[model samples]
Target: MTRQILLLSVMSLWALCGATHVKADHYRLEFPGMDNVLPIASRPANASRIFYAVMFDAGSTGTRIHVYTFIQKQQGELPILDNEMFQSVKPGLSAFADTPEMGGDTVRQLLKVAKRTVPRLEWKRTPVVLRATAGLRLLPEQKAQALLEQVREVFDESPFFVPNNSVSIMDGTNEGILAWVTVNFLTGHLYSDSKNTVGILDLGGGSTQITFLPRSKKTIEAAPADHVAKFDMFNTTYELYTHSYLGNGLKAARLAALGALGAEGLEWQVFSSSCLPRKFREDWSFGGVTYKISGVVDGYTGFKPCYEEMLKVVQGIVHQPQELKGSSVFYAFSYYFDRAVDAGLIDGTQGGMVEVRDFRKRAKEVCNKMSKLRTVSPFLCMDMTYITCLLKEGFGFKESTVLQLTKKVNNVETSWALGATFDHLRNLNIH
Candidate 1:
């Protein structure tokens, strides 16, 4: 059996996802102080065997549980994932800010799935964790804390092993890196002998993230200090460029483009835009707040007007990568996959890849369609236009950039949750 050593990396993301370290087959997590927690079980007289972990993602749109089952191939080596039982509940934990107990109940409900997935005898040995993202981070400090406290209580009542700082909000920066790790890991980029790794573009409801190992020295030298990060992994140190833009996701970007973000009163001013149906008017909810938004009742609307409005939301906000335009591969998921599916650009179950110009071409079609009549999504025009501008004007990508649109790779979810869980097992050194 080949031996592997999992060591501590950089500590910047610890504020978001906490920190973990391992030595001599013993795990030590500092930020959460997970000392004396569930150690690798030696019950069967073999330190190498099966193990289970439960991860809950309390995201802006929903709360999801990934009950991961793994088999330790050998001592001091990475565990092989046997299976993952995934399930989710809607409205997100942030929606229950005013009713925290209900938020706790949602967690308790998901724990039932964990209870069934993980064998009863292994219950006491399995560790369960929950990490909230942009949703809770957007809430008032008090409300977010209340919701977290509620989840902690729920975790305590469960039979599974719960660690210190079991529930908390994740940093936007870490979110990007984790997503990058997940895609690269699933695609075998981490295991191959190639010097390249695929980039990741995640568009969530409240935030969007971009991460990639920069091939250009200029990308690292000329970029903002905060955007460049270095971490140790795979027995080597890696320097990457990553960042998460808050309030720039598909949903939040709508509020921003509509001029409703941080607005004083919801009903005082009804935000009207050219991206909506001419007679469309409705109230939308996001991050626990509601707003009255509509489209112009009588005026011109189409790709031209919509693109102009969407441009304001991302014209100068996004920082372009120094070298992605030439010969780089990227995987764009979440809202990217969904919107492409909605626009008939790709299928939901079998997500197909698309070039950067493809999004532009589709955005024009969707926007022009909206200008004439209603399409499948009322927000289709705005969403597509935002993605288009966000990639081109915002991120400085050329229309030729190729982005592989996918929800899963190798039958595993290509989400940050997978990378987040890999943290617990230690990012394995690929043989």
Candidate 2:
């Protein structure tokens, strides 16, 4: 039996730099740290070869580090992955886009966590890498490149093995693909047939991704050329329906819904919407820009109009795959999980299954009772409504569609970072 170990109560996301020497049954993993937390088991023949890897996820909203430890029981066999040590810092690297050096400083600070976790002797052999997501993608090319260059300089100065192209912006397609891989791997579904794999829905701050293996040929034929992606992992070829919509993430959608996405003259403009509390007013910041936002003070507020407002962001904009209307397994994470927890729709610690209509029902309740629910986020009404519209209108899922909201599987976070690490290891041929 294959024992898959996933760490819970740790950090979330990717690593920084190079490759490793271990290969698992279907994938390769090399992350270092958290070994001390788990008792070291003595081994015979191979002496239990251990390897380490550090991955940094430079997301639009925050920067996070994941240090993973893998133990190889025998040569050429799958390494037993242990727990991961995760850490994070907020306001994301994009916030420091104009000040590239400051952005680099954040990475430097995160390296401290890696340094303290991985043993000193293993530093030189451990690979470190950083992959920026939608946040950096939205920045001007010059600014984004500048920030990436600064991070490269930081990686060079560190003690770990930094590979070529160690710090760069990750394309949206790969983001979705990797996330799908992470979830399926954690669920022990990687070695099974494609139909057994679960789809993934990732709502980041700057983008949202939807990826799944389509069982119907119509889905592949009807989708846009770019929406279909094919990659090789674990010696198997996977052709998946995947796409990451930039500017469709939770925070990005909030701006788009307010008609403030690219509007200028933020100093005087107060973008208002019926989705917020009637008296709510504040400044919101995203991707290095800030905007003044408020609720319609004397105007109408509630689910009816809010759903219509959010529908504009989804309807006609998000492509509805033909097969999604049928029964399919999907795991939603990131902001999708966060908002559901905030609305009492699901437990934060223990995720649960919910129907597509559940979001709609909750949106109606939350939007209609915003005043009494003042303790929750003022934007709850808007978010819940938007999610409802995105699913039923944008994605074309049936109201009865079941969605599994989760952050972790077993003990490990279901994130793209793990899959990306496996991809990195395969590229290096570290063995």
Candidate 3:
């Protein structure tokens, strides 16, 4: 009886030891937000085993994938391991529709390259997060749904199998908010700082978003009962106002320009480069010099007409109706046109000017003309009441404040790219 008891005790001890070994090797992976891919991996040979988590930002014009490693000492904060970025011409929606697996295939190609470079990574345990941005959101609802379903199907076939809980599609509003937040955080314009509230204008390739945040004041008093309340502003707090205008990017600019010119029975010669539109390529002569216009047709209804139209749009969106009446309008298109000339695509002195001048000189001439028209136009003084209402509704700002924030630009990038806003949001932890 004693020998039998000893044998049983020995078996029980071995079982417990094996269990401990298995538990010690276990690890967990996490991904935040639905729009990104998270990749996780383990390094077995190192003295202190390391695990990595990666996220991919799949945008319409480019793809950015950032890898991060879990730091146990830092309470699992994932630090960047490797960041990769690639830009491609916008792909057609039909392409993704026909091959749902293409999205996964593209991801796999990227991962394959990453893994090959980092040979120590354990492929079996890696978890990847994939998120699509403007490209997916621009699609019609049925098309977007189909595209997502295809992405899921392909992602499942990857070497690193995704658990059922590992994937999601971010809602459009959330994506817009997060993108707005990210830009705000990076530009030092987040409302968390008790300085003057900053207004943000973001012009993307397909859409534009305008946001406003209330300035934080440092002179506070009582502690809130809820911890979250410290950051929360009650109804008394200044709120963020945002306006997202759809179909207003470069492509839209071209379409609107074409529509306007078509009504007038005029057509500008098209340029070979996809970036340059037909109307902008028309040959023009001034002061005995002929010049070829480059860059996308900047605004609808031609230069002067479009400028007036935009002013009305801006006036309507501002808080004070009269503030913009005589304000200086800054032209943003000059830079874009200057770049095109620098690239040697167009000649500015073809009409036989005595001296050949750079693109800047030509752009300056164009801007001067537009500015003169804005100053002299009789129709420029119309009431901006409608625009003011839009500004109030879109950005949640008082009508007066909206008027104060109104500014004009000749180009979209200089006026309202979302990069700055994205930065601000990151700092505020909205991303």
Candidate 4:
């Protein structure tokens, strides 16, 4: 019952949000007169009523569209999440940094998916928003804004409702918070006073996030001020420990590990690492830039050197939360799950649990046998080692700490998009 009321409240808040453009930089929901909000029972129940929301996840590596359909079975109750239509395209919007219109074209192509998923009659009423993640955040300010302006023009041209500030770069903190909301909400752990909520580790291409409801007050007090956030929902205030580490994402880490992050001379420079197969060399493109990467043919190639190189990227860079070493359930997703799958550490379809040491174990095996594993990605060794180092050293998780690797929950993509959608609706659209 509490969860239901919360969901209804979420719907109310979403409605209020539609009235204006929603900035994704900070999530501070302040609902005035929330105490006197009408009960769901007071409103007319429309069992056949349905609504849809369209969210665009502009990430470092790809751009995705999520179309959510909700059914209001009765008043004063949470609407049923009927289904989601999702699609994605590679080389994310950031790839078009030099060509803003081309980036908008990608969004235009994805909007076709939304057009087909949503009913024609509901087109004008449906809210469409695009939120860029670390990908855009990593770009130059002018370039990022240019890309956003292009997307804004596209949104305005579309039949959907284009709210103000609909296209913008999301704040790293809010990214973590929304993703936490997504996982907890899907797991049925969003109830008031619920202590069973799980923490989330999201490893995107250009950034990463760690968010959880701290069980100890010391966790909050010890954390950096920006690491903690408080928001009101369901008439309850939640203070969560969350932070997004920009430039620490999988792809970005690879660049940093190769010593090619922000360096020039990409055309003549060769970024080499001991993590790759001894003979491996390739031109990799990430976030609209290309880098020449290779393994040191004359140097040693194995886990030790690779782990050492990765250490420079993780050690002392990531914060160590005091409570993380204690008993806490965590869900690791995005690149954490992807790299685990690539390394054959877990089943791709059915995600499973593994300890922090499991990643280390796999990193060793993959790094030691790079020559024999021709079918695997050349960066597999580095990626695995990075995950291992990031977990054990970056965040200071115990080797035995168990992490649930999941790609989806209840058939919906486990990301901040849904949570952002819910937030978008709560603001109430006045049309």
Candidate 5:
């Protein structure tokens, strides 16, 4: 409580006095309320309380952009998140590996959203950046660089301010950390009376990331190399446990569970697995590659066999964090929220909290139904089971562990994009 009051006091001093140098990279876009006020950057700077930043999130499954407007509250105080204009496009940039132009075009289309959201007068001032995640990270080295180069071309063509380091692929460690920052910042945990922070479980299509500040030195010592990160924020130094598994994401794990990984003959023969329905067959596409898949018509099926299969996709591969088993709050986003909504465990409009056993229960229900319900996705059984294993046996979370599943907090999309924008703002000296 003292820390929170002191921090707010510092912010108040900055706001009321004058000159709060916000590092360009760490600036938080905020709007307290600016109906008739001008942005602090405007010529008539009294009303100049708001500034903008445009961020592009090029992920494994989709490309999204967030246009954030921040309010200065006063001349020099740290800004707060007033509002965010967000948009997304499907088939991620990696889908156009063979055609870089089309990949860049997707980015170009997203820019139209930014153009509309950010005022024309502010175009040259708002910094625009694109950061690709696991999807592009998995592409061939040359191919990934080619795709990035094409996207850079699109950024260059935009009217928005382009920072030198604006277009690049974010490392997986930073990905988890940025996401952690975004969630904490949104929850007001970072700037409040409570210093307690929540853990983040982000399951993307091609990768999954878990990040949180550890409570014990044992956790830091037991963690794998590059899994623990140390950084400074708000005059506090923090050591966070974070890691991203590249191929353990929901969609990729489905392919791995099906025994279809690296099977070249998609057109000649179908990959079969017990996780699917006994007679189900279809063409599955991921990361721009198509594979024909089917269930084992002559073999066993149902929850047990399916669970065992999906377990192999995560078990022994994911390292269990010791702190995760103890009492702590976790916020699961991306595919975690999507699957829960699909299973009717929660409403999509308002994501709900659920115990880890909830996933286990739904996995059994869905996989058991697959034998007779050939109408549904054969992979649904595997996907749900994989999610169950990921939280339980994979990460060592207990059955009673509670997870808050959400896509948005206060209307801003819960993602690393906002964190990325804040990180960029931090780079600037805004005193």
Candidate 6:
């Protein structure tokens, strides 16, 4: 009887070991410092293999968290999974100045959900890379350092317990490259072998980045020994040419419209006399320098003329040769002016009013001009309409594959986090 009991115990122990190994084969992980924590359903006990990746795009207006997973294929091709997005509270100027602890709190909350949902999740072995884009990069050095340190501190604790080797804050240029990779991946432009250089233009709420990837011949190149190194997309080795133009989408539209009158543009008195009251004009100034103008309330009644002038300026900037006319522009106008139109905050026909259609037309015209002038067509165009269509139909897998392969040919990395992580995994010989 004693011998029989021992055999039964040994058999039970063997089963437990096999189950642990199986669970480890399908792991869960989160990336960056989170604002929205993502939770996965129970892990599939029979899954062949699984990997997770996360991206945090901290912008001036808000924070976006994207969570994705790669499940090993059983037979045919694996489907590209849909990403889950979590948006943080809309940030104000005060939020930007807040201590990193404030941001850390947000990350902690997000991780709590991840811990509860992902089955047999292992924090130590999983890699989590955190990146802050134009918003934090433009903050004062002292504030930015404090924020980064705070984020690091939060990850050190908790169910996340991210390993020391797993977390990092990418610089602006690298962040821009990642953004490029994500966008291209979604649009289906990533390629494995091509010499096509890509220019990525990202316009966000608080800042804009213009990135240029020069041609190269390698699929992936390591960062240089120097503090700063070049990154290659696919077959193309590329250098980063980026400008963090402060005051992105909203500010850009406002400034462009207001600056139209040139030096002679309306003075405060004229501004007050037009549709806007004195208090409204003053508030619009925010902290920026105000332009002086004549014409009191009486001088500016029936100000339709002023509104028209504003529209003209906005149109000209959008179509300007020196601006985005010839570049492969990827303008994100969704966040901007959403409330304005919805709330009837401004009359679209007013002189200062700018509509989405206006920008779309300008983009179309620029593409047409580039096709004629340079004989090099604008490689890609992303707007609300395109995004909507892609989302509705579920971007066809073939198109996605073609795009990724094309990006590889151009030597540029597709802007997908999974693709980037896959490249990282290959480097580590994990696959």
Q: Report the error of model 4 at residue 364, Å.
A: 0.7
Question: Model 6: what TM-score?
Answer: 0.51
lDDT ranking, high to low: 4, 2, 5, 1, 6, 3
Output the better candidate (1/2) by TM-score: 2
Once fitted onto the true fold, the runs of candidate 4 whose alpha carbons sit more than 4 angstroms away are 1-47, 427-431
Strongest candidate by lDDT: 4
Q: Is candidate 1 or candidate 3 better by TM-score?
A: 1
At residue 144, give the lDDT of candidate 2: 98
Worst 10 residues of 1 by lDDT: 1-10
Q: For candidate 6, give the lDDT.
A: 0.38
RMSD of 1: 6.0
TM-score of 5: 0.89
For 1-431, candidate 1 gives per-residue lDDT tens digits of 11111112112222122323466455332323223556645465555567788989888888999888766444434445557788989888988989999999989998999988988989988989899988888889999999999999998988888877778898888788878877876666663235478999999888899999988899998888878876655445668899989889888899998999888877677999998988788788888788998888878787788888888988778888768667788999999999999899999999997888899999888877774546347899889888998998888888888889999775667788878876654532221
Worst 10 residues of 3 by lDDT: 226-235
Q: After superposition, how far is residue 301 of candidate 1 from its true place, in Å?
A: 1.2
Q: Which stretches of candidate 1 lie over 4 Å from their true place?
A: 1-37, 40-42, 46-48, 74-78, 192-194, 371-375, 427-431
Please report how far candidate 1 places residue 259 from its true position, in Å.
0.3
- Tell me the spans in candidate 6 whose CA falls farther than 4 Å from its real position: 1-47, 74-82, 92-96, 120-124, 161-170, 194-200, 211-230, 238-242, 249-357, 360-431
Tell me model 1's lDDT, rounded to 2 decimals: 0.78
Supply the TM-score for candidate 2. 0.88
Candidate 6 lDDT, 1-431, residue by residue in tens = 23332232222212211212224344222222321222343555655545455544455555544454444433222323323333344452225455567776766666654554344455433444455554565566677767667667766775443534343344544545555554444434444343243445444554544444433222114222221235543324444444334444443334443452223434433332232222232323321224542222454422243344334433322211122222232412233223222223334333123333443343334323332322222111112222222211221112111111122111222233433443343321110
| Runs in model 2 lying further than 4 Å from the true structure | 1-45, 192-195, 373-376, 428-431
TM-score of each: 0.88, 0.88, 0.46, 0.89, 0.89, 0.51
